[model samples]
Target: MDGRRPEWRACVLSGAVFAVCMAGTTLPTPLYPLYQDKFGFSELTVTVVYALYAFAVIGVLLLVGNASDAVGRRPVLLCGLGLAALSAVCFLCATGLGWLYAGRLLSGLSAGLFTGAATAYVMELAPEGGASRATFVATAANMGGLGCGPLLSGLLAQYAAWPLYLPFITHIALVAVSAAVLLRLAETVRERQPLRTVRPQRPALPPQVRAVFGPAATASFVGFALFGVFTSVSPAFLTESLHVDDHAVSGLIVALAFFSSTAGQLAVGRVGVRHSLPLGCAGLLAGLALLAGALRWDQMSLLIASALVGGVGQGLAFRGALADVAAASPGHRRAAVISTLFVVAYTGISVPVIGVGLLTGPIGLEGAGLVFIGCMAALVVTAAVYLLRRPEPARV
Candidate 1:
């Protein structure tokens, strides 16, 4: 272990920067309806615009998710920050629907680059003894950063002037400051390769890990799907069904899930990898049930309950699956394997939400949401059953 004081300091700094960049990605969450009103688009168009970001993220992850492991973390992260800035610029210059699409695409690229690279970078800079805390820092930064995005934007957009302009403007300032901090941080990958040497990392599981990867990846998919639906459609539900026009309230309702997700991930340290997965599955089941109640009753309390419960399930399952799969992977192929898992997880974020969008045209938003919850619930249950039948080894 290098065990240098500079290393720990840099680790925490990088995590803060990671959070800031991630916050930019979701800042538009609560503002989407405003964009829709301005751009004059359909609900389906909104989902399409939102899903575009996930597709872009998945594309970057598959194309070069492990690039930081080769070309050094700093360079790749800097690239991500650049994309983030470009996204902010896109949003700031929004004149029509195309700008929104461009912004989301760029944001996706930024997030895809940041997700694996920033995560590994933070962990690498920590003191060897501080692995557990460092892991929490990295994961919490990811989910928490995501949680803050909408809340910040919603408040500014709702009460502050220039809703469209202010959010991106504020994010631009954050990106600039974060870029300065990031530049001062140390590069963790000492023996770096050229960018050209990095190529697409397809999901290749090791034989031993292959057993655990399925249930784990499935949990990740289901969790992310729940989040996707929430991020894309739940706001519309809040406004239409609950008669909530308050952007702050809408943002807070959405933020609840991501915040709960961070709390759920933190629980993994105490719960252990073996138990977190099943517990996550349980949380997911309960969450889905709550969401069904929300749909049936149209109660604001039920909706909030669903978000909190579902977020916890997502966090527990994702963290547990990630730790187990990472442990089971051979050192040489570890990055690619984890990237593969993320590819699956990110796919969940896009496809299912789009499915809901399509269904919304045929049925109403609530009806489509009911169908979505039912489908996702069945998948989560299948995954839970499989995990029960083939429990992960305690150490893994």
Candidate 2:
């Protein structure tokens, strides 16, 4: 019992560190408006800046996503923390747009490193037969941390001094404390390897995984795309159309989607993975409809509803997809297959938001948002149909 207690403690401690790193990634969500005002840039610039982080994350996932498996987890995670600190520093010293770009890029790298590695570490830290509960811990830390980012920054930006500087500064301190905690935890990987032996992981799927991967990947894509739109553009919508200027409210609205996603993920345990995907699609479709109504009528209530419902859908679909895909892949190539799914997910986050940014100038934010919703709705409906028609096999 004493031995098991320490393992659980380490598991929880690792999850806390995971949360801290992820919180840094979304820390700037509510601050984008302030950045636009300060830098005299257009809305397109904000979307581009946000997309840059996704792009960087994709790059790292492709390039070195499996580094921790080769080198020790502690080394890779420490490097991620270093990148996060640099990102914070860049934000603190922002003289121009360049600083924001650099900061976001570094933040993306930090997230990329943490996403796969930290998750594996947390799971490994759990006592034997604790895989199921550990999975929830890793996922909650991820979505919960992302949710906390904007909430924390929004409150600090609104109520506290240094709207710009204080949030990142606080994050830096958290990063430091997290690093110390990480150092104290024993390394989980039994066989250590040099960084030079690590190779960039290419996205690959075994022949058997292709069938399930399609619907799974599609659901994952639409789910992340919805988040991309929410995190990148919802605040602008609130400020421009609703004329709601409070940073805390804006942060809470955006954070709602992520927090709701966490809730959706928790439901997967009860809903069963097979049923979760199609049900999640229904939720996403409803959420998109709500967003459309919000956009058309400029109703704040509808917008909030959209965030909550869509977030839950994203959570359910993503977690279900992940669970299904992981079960199907061969153990030898699991990491590579999972990385490919993430590549698709992050692409969803990047491409659609950039498209919205491009269309914003010609059609206005509302029109662009409507267009995005329509496209995503069609995609989610298709995925739902596929899932319903050919339910994912218990094992593909």
Candidate 3:
């Protein structure tokens, strides 16, 4: 085990690298309004652009989710960073809507590769008896890095000159540093195969895992859907409805939701697996209600509260869903099973956000938002009820 300390260090370093790569995905969150102004596009177009990223992520997850396992983590991560660099370049040179769509799609590819590989890599790097703590580190890096992206870009864009170009330029530098850091980390795969060995991954359910998958997936779906709406449209809402136009303020608000989610995920260990799902569902339901109230009242305070409370609920439910599904999955198929759950979670992020975007033309932002809140609330309530009826799974 003496040799494992170095692996642990390598794992932590890799997780940090993963965080930096993922951060690039949201670097444009606070700047969406700026893009809208430059391109003269509607809010619906903004959401469509955002949904494109989710679509790319899902596509990669379905087609090559296990590429890292087969070909080696380092290569996959390096490729992801390369794609991320290209994405930054696209944004830096963006001239039209197509550029934004291409950039988002590239960002999605980077995230898709990192998500599963980085999580497993971190756990593998941990010392004996350190799995649980390592899980937090990996997850925190994932969500926390996502939170930091907009915060960093927004602040830079607001204070520094070249609001559009500077953010991607900064991301390029960070990605370079992250790539260098990743090169020094040890490869977790023992007998890595050739790239040709990679194949499309199919999502399937084993009977044993089906019982927990339902409620856990439900909560995860609603939770991610909440996040989807917040990240995709909240900045627009802040500018249009609340008359708060500061880019930094908008980024900070969105960051708060993701950061709060990290905090909420941390609570799951104490909450226990059984209670985490139901309790998280409760938080999601409350968050949806708060969001609906915000839309109805047109209050900035309500938006902030919805972000904080709803984000916490999302974090709780998301982590719980992952844990529940992972525990129930057979060892051999664990990665595949987990990928399926993520597909479900990410589906939540895409479909509903697009629905809102589609509805924006007919009903307006407030009306569309209210409709989203109602649907998500119903889903969360359903999940909570299911949790209540079924016996809680045995905790690890």
Runs with alpha carbons beyond 4 Å of true place in candidate 1:
1-6, 394-396
What digit string (tens of lDDT, one per residue) describes model 3 on residues 128-189? 77766677777778888889999998898889999999989998999999999988877778
TM-score of each: 0.96, 0.96, 0.95
Per-residue lDDT over 47-97 for candidate 1, one digit per residue giving the tens place of the 0 to 100 score: 999999999989998999889888888889999999999999999999999
The window of 10 residues in a row where model 1 has the poorest summed lDDT is 387-396
Give the TM-score comparing model 2 with the true structure, all chains together. 0.96
Highest lDDT: give the candidate number: 2
**For model 2, what is the alpha-carbon lDDT of residue 35?**
92
Candidate 3 Cα misplacement greater than 4 A, ranges: 1-8, 394-396
Local error of candidate 1 at residue 345 (angstroms) = 0.9
- Provide the lDDT at 298 for model 2: 95
> Roughly what TM-score does model 3 have, to 2 decimal places?
0.95
Winner of 2 and 3 under lDDT: 2
Ranking by lDDT: 2, 1, 3
Q: Ten-residue segment with the worst summed lDDT in candidate 2?
A: 330-339
